[model samples]
Target: MVEHSNRKDSRAAEAHQSSCLDPFGTWKMSNAAHGFGYPSFVSYNGLEMVWAILFYVPRWLWKNWEAGKVSALRMDLNLGIISEVEKKLKKKLLIDYMYSNLKHHNFWAYRYFFCEFLSLINVGGQMVLLDRFFDGTFFTYGIEVMSFADRDQEDRIDPMIYVFPRMTKCTFHKFGTSGNIEKHDALCILPLNIVNEKIYIFIWFWLLIIGFLTFLVLVYRAAIIFSPYIRALVLRMRYRRVKRECIDMVIGKSYVGDWFLIYLMGQNIDSVIFKDVIHELAKKLGYRSRDIGET
Candidate 1:
């Protein structure tokens, strides 16, 4: 009697677990024959919704506000006060940070760097999410698809077919008129996988490209942080009229944060005014702009 009761309890526990995992019923997913689909889509859909609303959207808006807004620091400070600002730029004075939070006047250099870092994290996270959702096959999915052509025709089973089967069996349970249970079985065909396979393949390649580019962006950020040459090079690319000697001297004296502030200033102010500022800054730092009076 105890053995029978234990067997019944075991079956009840399994039923409860299955109901928790598949609340809508397993008949929608699989039957006794095969189990190709997973319940991961529920988590994946929730992830997309929560990640976008809580994570991506707020950062996107903040980044846009920070980058697209005007810089009063670029416009307000001129040669008249270049002497004062030059002192601040060269040394970490007590008052330098007082003006840091004024409207559109932030250096935002480290914020920009961290945004790039988040982008790397985002790409990496999506890869992991896909891998988890696809049952760990997503990492090598692209490779398997690419190499499928080289295999023997008979041996070449499309990876998409295994990942997303076109056909499966379903079983449904119901109550009969006599109070007994009724079972209904049917074979289901998923035409959607035809389009889904192609879509996921494209996403796989696109993620690779985005991941590579984000890594390069991080590398570039690090390069500018460590190398003054790269700092000057970036400034030169933005405003051509700033004399090379002035840039070299200015960057040589400027901290990475100050240099980054100047770099961000490039997009806001006029190039001619920008050139004049560089020249005056160089003069304040006791170096002359090389191309004197040259347009």
Candidate 2:
């Protein structure tokens, strides 16, 4: 008798679950599993707007650098923490401010790296938001679409279609003339979801690409900071004409911040002129016994 009662209770629970999933199950507005994407659309649209502005900051920083006098970026006396220590050496504080915007190159480079990291975080946050919006289906969304082709068409349902259905059913209720209730089923063709489907599909793949690239940038910057050889190698690549000894000397004498500032200055100045600058910088810095690298 107890086993029979247990079975009955299990069945009741299943029925309740099914009914909860479909409040109007009797009228049968099927294909409601998507939960209509998101109950509220405001948050997801706001996240997309944030993603739009993500790349603009680094672009603006680079643009302002266009006006800097290339010759003023010279490392005449020393390197590192130019904002405070180098103020006495500044014949033209305004021009120095243009190029030596940060206290030191390491700080600028670190900030730049943080920007890359923030971009990665932004992508991850958006992906998580999308997963929550779509009820945990968005995480594997792109992978599922790619694998959709390999599966047998007989039983396979397109994830995209499942998540963003072109047609959905709605159950409507009304009162008849006899004061009795009547139910009606209606199919809705979501023309907007057709566009939405394409938009999110592109965003899914694009964000993956961007996230991967940003991660690589972070790794590359990390290597440059931790490994002196990498710093020297990158400097060599920047100006092949710059001497190997000079590159090693600069990398050894300077810390990550100083190295980074010089690196950015290299971008604005001509390579031949940059080679002379490095050569002169190394020659002058060699005479100083004080090691500011630790500083």
Candidate 3:
């Protein structure tokens, strides 16, 4: 009789425990469903649209901006230092970084070096190299881009222990075999997203405008192929430099050629309209023209 009573009480306790955990299990299931594209990460169609825009619009804008801003022009600030050893070391490290970023497929590290550290090496020739070697030897954990680099100049200047920003960040690890063999991973971290994002948006907008104008030209050409005068005018306008140079040479012997051309253009029917258009453009662009003779 006592055994039967104890068994009944044990079963009741087990039921009570399950009841207590029931709400938690339900919450966990709900969270999993939400993560799996069920109304949790996104509440409605509008939220889904936001994600779509983030994926496509931002990517398209970034591509256009990068194309417009892309240049092979490398920026190297030569400090004119007399240390050949330092120069060799710098070059080797830079090459190593490039190789690692490209060869080993470590994109994050590569971008960090090129975008952040490269821009910050503007000190008075007193250079510093922070690599995988310095990781465990000097600091506790590795430094992250957001953690080390910030919008404020104070945070940026902290890494180098100097006023200017000139130090690279990397990772190093130790492997054990017989005693210990060390493995070092070099990393580059650049905190350029905030500034780069703004610049990218501006360039992308301008590129989009340029793209539309080009499309317009193509459409106009396809429709108006038979208009000889219009076609000739369009071609001339497309490559107006030769005509502009001839006009300038004829009337700009004693004056600045561009200003002389401007004066000549000011005296024409189309030129007057163009000047007004340009003035409106300047107003829209929020820039005032400097007076002549002011540099």
Rank ordering of all candidates by lDDT, starting from the highest:
1, 2, 3
lDDT of 1 by residue, 122-171 (tens): 87888898788776768878998899789888656677766655565545
What is the C-alpha local distance difference test score of each model?
0.62, 0.61, 0.31
Output candidate 3 Cα RMSD. Answer: 26.2
Selected candidate, larger TM-score, 2 vs 3: 2
- How far residue 113's Cα lies from its native spot in candidate 2, in Å, is 1.9
- Output the TM-score of candidate 1: 0.69
Instruction: State which candidate has the highest lDDT.
Output: 1
**How many clashing residue pairs appear in each of the predictions shown?**
0, 2, 1
lDDT of 2 by residue, 1-295 (tens): 6974454334323221211113432222222342332322344466667666765755565445534433455544234334645533442342334334433555556666666676678778878877887766688888878898898776466767656555555555678899897777665454555776788888899878988998888899889879989989998887788787877877777778767767876775545555655665665556333332211
- Candidate 3, residues 128-167: lDDT per residue as tens digits? 1211222211221123222546536632423222111111
For all predictions, the C-alpha RMSD in Å is 9.8, 10.1, 26.2
